[model samples]
Structure formats: structure tokens, C-alpha cells
Target: MVEAARALFVREGYHATTLTAVADRAEVGHRTVYVRFGTKAALLRHVVDVAVAGDTAERAVAERDWYRAALTGRTLADRIEALAEGTAGLMERAADLFEVVLQAQATEPELAEAFQAGRADTRGLLRRFVESARTDGLLAETTDPAWQEETVALAGQAETYLLLRRTTGWAPEQYGAWLRRTLTHVLAAPLR
Candidate 1:
């Protein structure tokens, strides 16, 4: 049902997608969708969550290998590179659906809340990375950890990836490399 809804939402969009259509696509009863998801907004939220997490409900973003590499990297540059690669993969998979959700936010209160919640979650993850960098003495003495965290969070956003990939025709690899280099320059301490 989630797969069905995701495909429909991507092809037909949020406003045009109906519960009956989702049921038909999934080959399930209408009542099954209603009973499982309760509402279209709830179903959309599930779709977004699954997409952002790369189609797995079992593991979280932090548990992913790429994210783990970022957290466990030997230096801030390595960490930023790993983070950029991971974020590029995520944006490639979820950018379209995220745009759909963003568009629906004005009309759907639940989706609006979900969008904000997702941003907060991203911020929290960046904060953890910033704290780790500070602990490892990878940050410059003059660097403001809070400001760096916010900058990383904003730089890692899906919209930036979408813009570069979609509007500028950059491949995912190119985008990832650029992101890694840009973030390293922006967030890393000066080399001795």
C-alpha cells in the first residue's frame, strides 16, 4: 500500500491522488487503506518517511553506513565528505517526493507539521556532527559551533541538491563531489 501510494503521489501528485486510486493500485480494499493509514495526510507522511529513509522502516538515517562513516571519520574533512555523499544519495531518491510534500504543506496541516518535524530532525543530526567535531578538535578556535551546525544543516538540504541536479544538469556524482568540496572549505578548520 505504501509503495502504491508513493507511486501515485509521484505521478499524479498529492491533490490528485485519491484513497480509492491507491487501493486500486495496491490491489487492496479501500477500507484496508483507511484502516491502515486513517487519512491521506497520514499516508503521505508515511510515504515521505519511507522515501527519506530509503525505503526501510527498520533502520534509521543514523544507522546507515554512509552516515556512520561521517560520524566515525578521522577528520572534519572526511566527515563532511561522507555526509555530502550520503545527502546526495538521499536527495536523488527523495527530492521529488519532498517537493510534493512541500507543495502540500499549505493545504495540509499534518504535512506542514511533518515538514517542520523533518527539518528539526535534520538540525539535530547536524548538531551531533558539530559537537563531535568540536570534541575531536577539528574545528578552528574561532569557529562558532552553533553557527557551523546551522550552516551544515542548511547546506545539506534537499532543495540545494535538487537545484543543482535538476536546473544545472549536474549528475549525482558531480553534485556530491561539489558538495563535499564546498562543505569542507566552508566548515573545516584551516590546515596547519
Candidate 2:
């Protein structure tokens, strides 16, 4: 049902998509969707969450191998590269649906709140990474971890990926490489 909702929401846009249509696409009864998810907003939120989480319940983004590599990398460049690689994959999976949510947020108060909440959550994750880098002495003495965290969060956003990939015709690999280089230059400790 979540997959079905994702497809329909992407294809039809938020206002155009209906619980009945989702039911039809999933080959389930309308009442079943209402029973399972309770509301259209709830269903859409679930779909977005699942899509961002890579459609899995077993592990979170922080627990994923790529994320672990980013955290455990021996050098700042290696950490940035791993982080970019993981972010690229996640953006590829979630960018379109994330755009949908962003657009819908203008008209749906609940979706607007959800969008802000998601942004805050992402910022928190980036802040944690920045804190870890600071703890590892991989950041310059002048670097502000909060500022670096916000910068990295904005730089690694889905909109940036969508712009570079869809507008500028950069492939995912190119995007990842550019992100890694850019972030490395911005966040890496200076060479003595």
C-alpha cells in the first residue's frame, strides 16, 4: 500500500491523489487503507518515511554501511566521500517524493509541519556527524561545528541533488564526486 501510494502521489501530485486511488492501485479495499493508516496525510507521511528509509524496517540511515563508513573513515576526505556516496543513493531514492511533499506543504498544514520536522531531523543528523568529526580532530580549530553542520545539511539536500542532476545533467557519480570535493574543502582540517 505504501508503494502504491508513493507511485500515485508522484504521478498524480498530492491534491490529486486520493485514498480510493491508492486502494485501487494497491488492490486493497478503501476501508483497509483508512483502517491501516487512518488518514491520507498519515499515509503520505508513511510513504515518505519508508522511501527515505530505503523501504526497510531493519536498519536506519545511521546504521547503514555507507553511513558507518562515513563515520569511521580514517580521514576527512574519506569521510566526505563516503557521506556523499550515501547521500547520493538516498537522494536518488527520495528526491522526487520529497519534492512532492515540499510542494504539497504549501496547501497542507500537516505536510508543512512534517516537512519542517524532517528538515530538523536531517539537520540533527548532520550536527551529530560534525560533532564526531570535531571529536576526532578532523576539523580546523576555527571551524564552528554548528555552522559546518548546517552548511553540510544544506549542501547535501535533495533540492541540490535534483538541481545538479536534473537541471545541469550531471550523473549521480558526478554529483557525488562534486559534493565530496566541495565538502572536503569546506570542512577538512587545513594541511600544516
Candidate 3:
């Protein structure tokens, strides 16, 4: 039932979707849905959780290449490139579910918190990546761990906007090159 509601929610959006619609999609009676979930809000939360979990899982799996490349001295530039490209691929692949979550957050403040949690998780992951770079002496000694992660997060947001809006013809490699060069100035250790 939850799965059916999620599909309908994605297809028609939250505001337009109703319990009846969800029930129809699930091939269950409307009374059953109401009895099981109690209210539309509960079902909405379930749908959002399910979608967020899926997105997180997919992104984590896709990022294995990034961890491998980074650990292998493949070049921060190259690894960063893989990161951006992998993110874009994930976003495009999960566009429907993402769109549903996006729309839900527009009207539901509670859903916004869930979305922020997702962002925080991404930031935490990037912070760890930055810390690893620092420990490896790849980044400058003066760089703050927090700031490094923030910069990466900002760079990622820009890359996402570009990819989603088709703002340019950048292939992932092109974007990654730009990011690495930018970061080199921002975080690279000064030459002795």
C-alpha cells in the first residue's frame, strides 16, 4: 500500500494525490488505507522516508569508484570529477522520486527537515573526505577541516545546478577539472 501511494505520489505529486488514489493504485479499498495509515500525513512521511533511503543507498553505491580512485592516488582532480559525474548520474536516475520529495518540501515544513537531514549527511561525508585529504598532506596545513568541506559542498551545489539546468555543455571531466583547479587555490598547501 505504501509502495503504491509512493508511485502515485511521484506520478501526480503530493497535493494532487489522495488516499483514494493511493488505494486505487495499490488495488486496495480506501477504507483499508485509512484504517492502516490513519491519515494522509503519516503516509506522506512513509513515502518520503522510502524515497530518501533509496536515493542515499544509490548514491553510496555509485561513490565506491570515488573512494577507490582517491585512495589510489588517482588525482584529487580525477576523483572529484568522478564525484560530480556520479552525483549527476544519480540525480538523473532518481529524478521522479526526487521531484516528489522536492514538491513535498515546498508545502510541508516537516518534510523540509527530512530534506535537511539528507543534506547534512552529504556534508558529513564530504567533511570526512576533506579530513582524509588533510591527513594525507594533500591539502594546505592552514585549511580548516570544516571550511574545506563547506567549500566542497558549495562546489557540489553549483555543479548540480549546472547539470540539472543544462547550463552548459560540460562533460563530467570538464566540471571536475574546474573544481580541482578551484580547490587547489582555495585549499592547496603553499609551496615552501
Candidate 4:
């Protein structure tokens, strides 16, 4: 049901997608869709949650292995690769849905709230990462943590990913490489 809604939401914009359509796609009763997920906004949020987490597991993204690798990979470059690859994997799975959220946020309060909440979650995780990296001398010691966090956030953002994908026609793997190269060059790590 979540997958069906995700497909419909991405193929057809959020406003254009309906509970009935989701029900039909999922081959479930119309009431089942409503009873399962009260509103379209709620359903969309659920879909995003599943995509972001890569599953409906009740675990936070910070608990995920890839995210952990970003924090504790063998080397600075390895950590950077983990960050790039993890972000690329996430965007590949949900960038379209994120674009859908971006479009729908303008008029939908629920979606706007959800979108902001998601951003906050990303920033919070990034803040911790930058702090840890700085402490470990993986990032420039003199650089501001806020700057580092925001820079990484901007690079890993859906808007940036979508824009680059649209203009350069780069595939996900290509984007991941670009991210790795950009991070390695743009963020100078201090000598360990």
C-alpha cells in the first residue's frame, strides 16, 4: 500500500493523487486506504518515512549502518565516501517524492510542516556529524561547525540533487562520485 501510494504520488503530483487511485493500485478496498492512512497528507508522509528509512522499521536513520559509517569509517576519505554514498542512496530512493513534497508544501500545511520537520531532522544529524568530524580533526579545525553542516546539507539536498540530475543528466552513481569529489576538495580536512 505504501509502495502503491509512493508510485502514484511520484507519477502524479500529490494533489492529483487520490485515495481511490492508491486503493486501486494496491488492490485493496477504498475504505482500507482511508482506514490505514487517514488522509493523503498522512499517506504521503508515511511514504516518505518508508523511503527515507529504506524500510518501515521503527529505527531512526542515524541508527542505520551507512549513516554510522559516515561517522566511524576507517579514514577521512572513507567517511566522506560513506556520507556521499549514503546521501546518494537516500536521494535515489526518494528524491522524486521529496520533489513532490517541495511542490505540495506551498499550499498544504501538513506537507509544509512535514517538510520542515524532515529538514530539521537532516540538519540535526548533520550538526552532530560536523561536530564529531571537527573534534576528530577530519574537518578543518578553524571552520565553523554551522558552516560545515550547512555546506554538507546543501550538497546533499533534494533540490541540488534534482537540479544537477536535470541539467547534467547524471545518473545516481555519477552524482555520488560528484558528491565525493566535491566534499573532498571543498572541505579540507586537517592533518590527523
**What is the clash count for each candidate, in the order shown?**
0, 0, 0, 0
Where is the poorest 10-residue window by lDDT in model 4? Answer: 183-192
Assess the local accuracy of residue 100 in candidate 4 as a C-alpha lDDT between 0 and 100.
94
lDDT of 2 by residue, 44-132 (tens): 88888888778658677788888888888998877887888888888777878887888788888898898888777777676777778
Better of 2 and 4 by TM-score: 4
Q: Rank the candidates by TM-score, best first.
A: 4, 1, 2, 3
lDDT of 2: 0.82
Write down the worst ten-residue block by lDDT for model 2.
Answer: 183-192
- Against the correct fold, how does model 1 do in TM-score? 0.89
lDDT of each: 0.82, 0.82, 0.63, 0.85
Give the Cα error of residue 62 in candidate 3, in Å.
11
Candidate 2, residue 30: Cα displacement in angstroms equals 1.4
Model 4's alpha-carbon lDDT is: 0.85
**Model 3 over residues 44-160: C-alpha lDDT tens digits?**
776655453444344453256655454344455555555555555544444465556667787777767866776676666656666666677666666266666787766655235
In model 2, the clashing pairs are none
Candidate scoring better on TM-score of 1 and 3: 1
**What does the lDDT read for residue 95 in candidate 2?**
79
lDDT of each residue in 28-131, candidate 4, tens digit only: 99999999899999999999989988888999889999889888876778888888888889888988899999989988899999888877788777667666
Top-down lDDT ranking? 4, 1, 2, 3
Best by TM-score: 4
lDDT (tens digit, per residue) of candidate 1 on 47-129: 88788888765888888888888888998888887888888888777887888888899999999998888878887887787
TM-score of each: 0.89, 0.88, 0.61, 0.91
Residue 122 Cα positional deviation in candidate 4, in Å, after optimal superposition = 1.3
